[model samples]
Target: MAGTGTRLTLLLFSALGFWTLWGFPGKNNLLHFLGELSEPGASIPGPTYYPMKQKFTGIAPLDKQLTTLVGFFYTAVDGNRIDISLSFLNLGSQVLAAWILITTESYRAGNKGSFIITSTTLFGLSVVIVGYACVAPIWFALHLWTSKVVSNPRDWNIILEQPIKLAIAPVATLIGFGIPSAVMTLPAPSVISFDTKLNWSALQQGWPIWIYLAQKSLESIATWFQPMVSMRTEKQKRAEMVKYMRRAYLFALGTSAGAHLLYSGLGLAAYFLPGALSTKLQVQLQPENFFIPPNPFSDEKATTLPNGALWFLQWDLVIGVLATMIWGIAVRLSENGKQDDLGAWIKALVEYGVIAAAVGPSGAAVVAVWRRDERALKAKEE
Candidate 1:
């Protein structure tokens, strides 16, 4: 056996490998499925076959080339028009944009500290990709769940024997579990703004664009009210940034895992339910394999399930709102007299909500420092 450190490294690598290979259910295995297309007469599912190869063009030539190559490869593999797989095109464009911007920035910055820049860019991109991996599947699941395709009688099964109980039971159960989970994940004010008077350059260079934008918006709202939170020293700000980054990672893992768990449980239930589905409906619904269940060891023959991840996200969001309301009320209640710090909490909430709404709740908390500096400039002018 390898040493403890070696074993740990292997374990971590294995986990990451699994994630990269099968993270988002049907989504991640595109390459594997595409490989099957290399074989003669492999049948691809869902998309209708098209003889003409599809081409994808983007804002940049390189983007156009890359997407087109991808589109062509997809068409080759599936015998389907690339345009039919709009998700891949959209994802490719966004990823291409992010890479181009990051690479441009890195190149313009020069080789003096190229390693640091490269590392940061890679880490940032990884985070972005991971965020998308979790989000896209959940979104698709939700879209599928609500679509007219699922409106058929055989598509869904009632959990309880009694019709009325079955109708409301699952929803009630979702409400009971989902709301609290969502609330607990809500970004607190501490995670939002800390009063660092960071400039625009600092913000643009250090934080994600969504975080920077949300921070700017939140700062504007705060300026309309007045200063709310206590300022942090540069050292303290750096420390807080590191802390928030870690928190963001944890939040992403938790939310994604929770979402996958929900998918797996519901999927298994639908798959195992007796007499609730006809053979045609069972094949059509694919209740066992949806969202891929976070299992890395599963083979190509894994049972497919219907996408229902979005339903989980909706429940989580409901909890987030409830949690935010509770937090807001608690802040109000805790405010004692004329010197209350309610404004700080309110500003933080605004900042949190803006970021959470723009990105997911796993979004970063402290990117509004530049806006604090902006408010300072305006104050100077006044």
Candidate 2:
């Protein structure tokens, strides 16, 4: 049997290989494909035409052409719309591969299924909580900046006739704050909250429901209050606001990277380590294979589950709802506190809500379907 050292070495190498093939270059390839799909009318010159093109464009056109070509290759492989399928597959592979690597690492670290379960459960929760937390400061900063930029009397003259816009500013700012607040208050079955008797059923109960409504109402009020609050002192507000913007940017980037690394590490360890260790042991280990549903963008339904009820619930609805909430919070918080004007604030809130509504549900839907399939596959093996 291979020693633990050998197994560790293999795991490292495997992870490195996966990252190399599917991480950096893969991202570039995906970008190239997107660019091509986005701008299909762009001409693609031959390799020999590089020197002539370089003189005119100040860069080799070959590089751009190559990216588009590679993107086209992946699109052909999927046999779907070049833009959509290529983007989906690239993202799916990156996330899935990251999870596999994380899962393997977690198992090696003696965390068991803690990595997978926590990562999956908190995936939605983190987006809502962390995402919004970061956004609050950013919005505050933006509002301050805009206020400073537009403070001049000359600028105000441009909107002298637009009294309604001025009146709407503060109200809009408060609503922007409300988005994250709503998300934070929403009931989610998290690893931490799971044992607290605050499950979905409890949340749906009278007290919880009332609390939810009250919180939403409070958030709406706060949204309106945010702009008015800033009007208290322009100088103090600008300084404080700038501080928040800086802090928020740092917080969002740092926390996001940290969270991604943590989850990815856990997922990779869970999915890959067992098989690797078994291979070293020469025991022909049939490591559990998690089901990953096919891309919804594909022609097929991509539903992997056969037990209709479980499949529908697991793959179709719950996780997606969670993801939507999380993403909604993220976008809302990210854009919050950026305006002293009610109209601008309202516009920001509406924009974030729309984005979150569309993206959150769709993203969550995909994740739920994937996780459900994984659970079902594991069950079958057992």
On lDDT, the candidate that comes out on top is 1
- Candidate 1 clashing pairs, residues 3+ apart or interchain: 286-305, 289-304, 289-305, 290-305
lDDT of 2 by residue, 1-382 (tens): 1122322333343343333222423333433333543253532221211111112223456444433333232222222222222222223222222222222122221222343322422332332222212222222222223322112212111111212222332233223322322332233233323212112212211221232344346545655867465344544443443343233223322322343343334335445675443332222112221123223223332121111111121222222222322322222322232223446545644654453343332332233222322333344346
RMSD of every candidate to native, in Å, equals 21.8, 24.3
Model 2, TM vs. native: 0.24
lDDT of 1 by residue, 132-246 (tens): 3333232222212332211211111101111221122223322332332233222222342211111111122223443334434554554466442225454443344334333
Model 1 ranges with Cα > 4 A deviation: 1-7, 10-45, 48-124, 127-212, 228-258, 277-281, 284-382
The reply for model 2, stretches above 4 Å from the true place, is 1-231, 270-272, 275-292, 297-382
Clashes of each: 4, 42
Q: List the global CA lDDT of all models.
A: 0.31, 0.29
